[model samples]
Target: MSFYKKDNSDYLEQAFYSLQGQTLPADEIILIQDGQVGADLENIVKKWSQRLPIRLFVNRENIGLGMSLKKGLELCSYEFVARMDSDDICHPERFEHQYNFLKSHPEIAVVGSWIAEFSETIEKISNYRKLPSDSEELFFFAKKRCPLNHPTVMYRKSDINKVGSYFNFRFQQDYHLWGRLLNSGFRIANIPKSLVYMRVDERLFNRRGGIRYFQIETQVQKTFLDIGFINKLEFIRNYIIRGCIRLIPNSLRKNFYETFLR
Candidate 1:
């Protein structure tokens, strides 16, 4: 998991607590300290070290999500690596289900579950996001969109490395990786269970908008086209749709997303 300066101390503790309470306990909690997150957060990490088997790595300079994850993967000891957000809450049975599933289906390279998006607190779940269960369907879905919930995924490290790991995409790095994995014939699936409670708010829509994200959307669409994951028609259609979405008002975009897209 990766955390930066903006992550809250209480939320970080809650996240660690959730990991600590997992039914199938984690072998090692590989926490990436993305740049300097201050002394208070360090104290939180130090406190959790005694309870959770944390493998902490500190980054002297902030490298963002893609590079940070790439750096973290090299430090991982196990074959299967589960992705967790520093502030999100994972259900106690999440790792148990994903681990068992991966063990049983050795051919599948990645597995992710649905997520309940909450605002304020986990109990205040405001939205839900679900993905296809079948590998073929999910692969087709990846041609136009991200195939998995980033934080809810458990992926094979070797498979991820084979596809060049996580590239330095400023935005939607997981989407780009999923596109590459699917294009390379790596299988993936979803459990159809909401195993993670992801925190989000209206600010999410704001982040998705603005000039930077709009530019990032264009770059992502172009990346997919260059990778052969999407054809000319899909490239044009996706770029236009995402650009318009980014250009729209945040409240309107959120309503449109929750109403039709989600």
Candidate 2:
């Protein structure tokens, strides 16, 4: 599944190329246009539709990522669905590795991999986002940070549905969903290797630190507390730590994230 909202023809083309070029290529690609997009983006999708098994869903109005993914999940025909972002590029062996892991480990409900963060090109990776590989560690990690890289995850559709599909959240939706799944007794893990190239630039850093983003972050933490996934102490600690990080300047925040968080 993938979602896009604007003119991203180059990224969309590369994403499709990477997907179709995968060693264990995706059986189907569900591309959701969250709202009306540019003609270039539409043309690119139209071109790929003819070459790939892509099912396009165009929302008349912007519905945000969570709703877009929720709708995409309903149309998936397979048991396991891999999530991707419009601008990210998956490794050639990403699907093969993830599928084999899931096939071998039936107990796991969701599996994600580390991602290499880059600005312009994959070769110029500026940072790496690593994650815990076990359920226990992931559970603890999720209390403070997002345990799974959302765009690099391959999750079981039945398990996601059982825990309740994606919520209508503006930010940290993946983190919130993972918390729900964990509370519902689903296991999550991550591959140790980086399987995707994640695009991260100054804009991403700025977006993550603003007041609007902090509001959504606090809301998600409160929901986790209310659901019994996190205790009062954990909630307070998370708020303090995350709030402080978000209050810092963007340059400092980026450095802190690259040096400490990741």
lDDT of 1 at 258: 94
Question: In candidate 1, how many clashes are counted?
Answer: 0
TM-score of each: 0.97, 0.97
Looking at model 2, residue 81 earns an lDDT score of 96
Candidate 1 structure quality by residue, lDDT tens digits, 8-90: 99899999999989999999988898999878899999999999999899899889999999989889999999999888999
After superposing candidate 2, which stretches have Cα over 4 Å from the reference? none
Where model 1 places Cα greater than 4 Å from the true spot, the runs are none
